[model samples]
Target: MKIYSLINEFSSLDPCVFTLGIFDGVHIGHQKIIKNLILRSRKKYCSVLLTFHPHPKEILNTNKKFFYLNTLSERIYNLKKTGIEHLIVHPFTTNFSKLRTKDFLKKILHPKSKIRKIITGYDSIIGKNRDSSYEELKKISHKYGIKVYKVNPYKFQKKIVSSTHIRESLLLGNIQWANRALGYFYTLSGNVIEGKGIGKMINFPTANLQIDSKKLIPKQGVYAVKINYLNNMYLGMLNIGINPTLEKENRKIKIEVHIFDFFENIYGKKIDILMIRIIREEKKFNSIQELKKQICMDKINIQKFFSCEKKIR
Candidate 1:
């Protein structure tokens, strides 16, 4: 997909069939909209997707911490995987947040992509001060001659599939259910960096993942995960904690992953770790021996989980 940082890049093209949303998690609900967009785009001969970085909430409320399902790069990567042809990622800022509903439609959505058809959810809103709604969009569509497709909201496991729901699940360390709604594993991506070799000392050497401190980490726990190194997938036991058992005084939480049956230096390599299941919550052991014993059980549990999953698949 061609990513356009600014709308002017496609200023001369005819109106395109597109969908707009934060598309966080690109969860099942978002997938429906994107799927419809692809089908419609094929019929209309124009495929486009418009999303915002920094999220509207982040821009409108500076005091609040920004929590997102996918990082900017991850969002674009996931969208491109969906066969979207054009991607317009606008930077969300306080000034942009002030655009009136009509102005946003006319100035940004319509003029920028000259969108022929807008596919959005009934609850989706945009424009200055969050003034736009499905009702307003319909009226605007009638006036502008652009078609609007309002997709129905979707539910999974008897609950609405949404970014908020997924965030709640992850924050509570519910990976399996979150993955069901996400339509895939919830992955954390970053570069592997050198650490203090504490894992080695404990006889469970691991890869330390260096990531954005601002990134919303899943609840502190040990999890069954799959780490993608280069192009190979390896089952791993991932630990996210403050290392209380070790009495580490840095107070910095660390993400360490122990790859099963693998023992090689992977420092500095970029990797993606997809959380599959939460094995246990983080806790401080009475001694190093106790912590080591718990780690053994974690590995065994992870092995069983993956084995069962594979068999079911």
Candidate 2:
């Protein structure tokens, strides 16, 4: 996919079928629009996925904190897998947000991508004060000689698949619901960094992770996870929290993974940890032996989860 950063690169005037959104998790609902865009593309019309950086909320200076399911890089990573032809990542800012619906349509939306058709959800809107509506979009699209297609809500597990719901599910440690809505496991990917080697002393050596600060971390707990290290998939258990059992001066949250039966000098290597399910909440154990016993139980439970999931498959 060709990535055009609207902040630094000149916009492409290629005529294409396009859709626009922040697409936080690019959950099942967002994927529906993307899938349609790709399907709609033909010899005459190419597919374009347009999104924004800093997210609109940050630009709007909203009171709500921006907690996205995927970081910008992660979003790009997932979008690339969808086989889209082109992507335009417009930088969202206060000035950019000032563009009213019509101005946005005329200046950025139409002219830059020369969109022949737009594929988006019925409730989707972009611009100041969430100003655009499906009805309004249809009107302007006609004037611009463009076709507008609204995709219905994509539902999973009886509820509409959405980024907000996915984030909520993850925060609540409802991994099954979140993963179902996401159409894939939510992942924490980053470099493995040096750690205090406390896990090694306890015979449960772990890889300390340095993840993106902006990425929305799931609730603090122990989880069953799958890790991809240099193309090898490993069954793993990870803890996401400051080890309450340890009396460390800095009680900052940490992500530590223990890949079952795998041992290697993985420090400085990048790895992707996919959250499968939350096993238990982080707790302060009375002794090191108690912590070890809990970890052993976590391992057993994770193996069971994988075994049951395989049987279901």
Candidate 3:
């Protein structure tokens, strides 16, 4: 598969099957659209997946703001696994956001990229202020002689799957539900950094990490997590909150992971943590003894969670 960051740089002359969207999480909902695009492309044209960078809201400075499930790097990594033939990550700018539906179709989709067909979600919209809808896309397609297909809703159990639904679930500490929609564990990757040596004194050593500012942080809680580093995966427990019991002043939010049965010099190493389940909400203890006791119990609970090998249903 080939990736293009600039439209002017693309020299591919083939007419291709195309789809365009933010595709935030590349969740199950977005996956269905990509799957359809691939299935349709195999028979005739090269598949093209066009997405945006920096998010449109960042450029438009809209009042409606959102936290993303995956960063641009994460999205590109996930897309490469989908067996697509071509991927275009177009930079979103204020000037591009101002294009009307008609001009966008004529200038970008039709001539520049040679879109033979466009696939999108059922509720997808484009153009300024989201003025374009499924109907508008169909109307414009007729003038350009391009085919348009709207992917049907994807569902887990009985509820419809959406990026918004997944974000809400994560923010509320529902990792299992959000991971179900994601088709994988919700993950964060960062460099392990030095932290106050509180965990060490308590017999539980932790590796502190600094995550991206643009990334969406899960709800403040203790969770069962899996750590991936040095090409190995280890079961771990993570705490995502200010260390209330350890710090009474100038508290700072942090993510610390205690890897079980593992000891090595990992400071400055990049690690990826995948949240599997929430063990408990974060709380302050009256004494250090209570906090240490609760942590011991949490380790047992995480072991049980892994022992049962509860896979998403």
Candidate 4:
């Protein structure tokens, strides 16, 4: 997939079918749109996919904290896995936000990108003042001689699939449900960094990871997860919390994971944590001994969850 930051730089000799959106999680709803776009593009013999960066909400609303399931690079990585050929990630700015619905289509979508068919999720809306809708988009597309297609809703367990639903589930520590809707594990990748080695002192050496601070973290808790490092999969018990039990005078949040049956120097290496299930909420203990005891229980629970032996595989 080719990624371009400016619409003017998009140069697809083949006619293109495009889907425009922030696509925060690229969740099932977004998948439906992209699937249809790719199918349509294949039938029409064209390249496909146009997305935006910095999410429209980040550009339009300044007061709210911006949260993302995946970082920009991660999002692009996941999207490319869907086999898109031409991916345009135009930078969102105040000037882009001010463009009227019709002007945006004529100036950017139609002329610059040469989009032949525009596909979008059913709930997509655009334009200044949020005036554009699927119905209105059809009207405008007709005037400009561009075909517009709105994908039907994607649902899981009778409810529509959406990034908002996924976020809520993750925040509530519903990893199973969220991953079911996402059609993949809810994964977080980060660089493993050196820490106080508290887990090691407790007899369970952990690889501390510093995740992207801007990305939304799942609920603070211990979780049963799979750690991917250097082409090996290891059963891991992950903790995301303030380590209230281990800290005596210091105060800081931390994310640490103890891989079962594994001992390796992984600091400075990239690790991918794929959450499988929530083990327990983070809590404080009376002493290091108590914390160690609780960690033992966490290990036992994780072993049962994975139905694996006491060894990491």
Pairs clashing within candidate 2: none
- lDDT-wise, the better of 3 and 4 is 3
In candidate 4, residue 232 scores what lDDT?
A: 90
The positional error of residue 74 in candidate 1, measured at the CA in angstroms, is: 0.7
TM-score computed on alpha carbons, candidate 3: 0.93
**Candidates sorted on lDDT, descending:** 3, 2, 1, 4
Note the residue pairs that clash in candidate 1. Answer: 99-128
**Model 2, range 66-97, lDDT digits (tens) per residue?**
77889998899899999898888988888888
Cα-based lDDT for every prediction: 0.83, 0.85, 0.85, 0.81
lDDT of 2 at 234: 95
lDDT of 3 by residue, 124-219 (tens): 666764655566678877667888888889989788998878989999999999998998889999999999888889989999999988788999
What TM-score would each prediction reach against the true structure? Answer: 0.94, 0.93, 0.93, 0.93
TM-score of 4: 0.93
Clashing pairs in 4: none
lDDT of 1 by residue, 238-304 (tens): 9998889885688888898999999888888899999988888889888989999999889988999
For model 1, the stretches where C-alpha displacement exceeds 4 angstroms are: 108-114, 129-132
